[model samples]
Target: MGAVLQLLSMAGSVLGFVFLTLCIASGLYYISEIVEEHTEPTRRFLTRTIWVIEILLLLLLIFDKFPIKLTIFAMGSHMLYYQNLKKFPYISLTSITFLSSCIVVVMNHYLWFKHFNEVDIPPQFHYDPNYVPPRRATFSQVSSFFAICIWFMPFALFVSLSAGDYVLPTTVEQAKKTDEITELNSETTAKLRGRTIGLARVVIHNVRKYIYSVLALFGIQVQRDYDNLGI
Candidate 1:
């Protein structure tokens, strides 16, 4: 009885983990949907945010005497990040601008990490009151810096940007075009040429569909997949 109880506890823990993970993913999906819907406003917000960050970095570089080289590098990365705005919310995953931005974010993180570590106070001076600490950032400073400058932009872009399928979303006008193409040649699959929903919607719809189909195959029906729509 004890062994059976232990097994059940472990199984319960596993289910709880899965439930939390699904909750997080669903929240992210919902946020992405909202961002895509308000593309113009999202774009404007990101653009203005870059300007504000740039000004803050400039102040650090000028007054705070942040490492000049690192400051310039951070500014350059922000510039690269700005390039993604040209295409707005929809960025091609493999495109040069997007790939370069990813690389720059990683590089900035490594450079800043190494810089801070180098400036960290040595252990030998721990008891020496006269031994002044190096101009290393404090806990609060580091936290605020990373939160505002280093990590903020990349995270913002991650949530705001979408690498959608190459096919555009079908609309009323595009539906007419698709029908014409289909009529011209039944061999042509114009139906697949466009997606009717956003990328997140597509993934959620397909995954739920596959799960339901699998359950049916196993003669298990927890719920019916009546609606094909997902945000």
Candidate 2:
């Protein structure tokens, strides 16, 4: 029973990791599409947010006794990521940024893991008979720290960072397509109304034809009024 439970637990962990990876990939693809569609706006938003985070990290390094080296490395990595934004949608630059961002994520995870481990460990008093250590981290505290420090920024970036391959149609192309569709619809409407045919009748006639085709696939023969509709 214990072996079965252990196997089940390992399977669940593997599945969860796979699901998380898929979610991150899908989110990055979606963000890349949005970034391609709105290049300037997306770039501006990312730039501002990255700068804000850099400032916060700088403050934390200055005042809080956070690991200065890791913090500085993270800041530099973010600057590299920001530089990639200037040449938006370029494959090489984006890939570099992604690699740097991954490094930054690993650094953050390592630093925070160290911090939490230190917090969890009770301090040792040298050869003291009456030495009392502080209480260990509660479940809530550990969970909150993990969410805020370890997972938050990386998960957010996984969703926010845009890939290079995902492309949206250009604004001009979209406008042209919209105009063409509008013209085609108008022309079709004019032709139908010119024949003194009601729009509802046209829709019903098309629907009936589609229904008959489906019925025919099921070996049920239904009469199709193709000639009388003047389609």
Report the lDDT tens digits of candidate 2 across residue range 104-181: 778767776666567433346666778766555677965775564445555544444433232123533654666753
What pairs collide in candidate 1? none
Best by TM-score: 1
Clashing pairs in 2: none
Candidate 2 wrong stretches, greater than 4 Å:
1-29, 93-101, 119-231
RMSD values for the candidates in order, in angstroms, are: 6.9, 15.0
lDDT tens readout by residue for model 1, 45-154: 98999999999999998998888999999998999999998877667778999899989999988888888778556789878889986576788987788888989888
lDDT over C-alpha atoms for residue 166 of model 1? 39
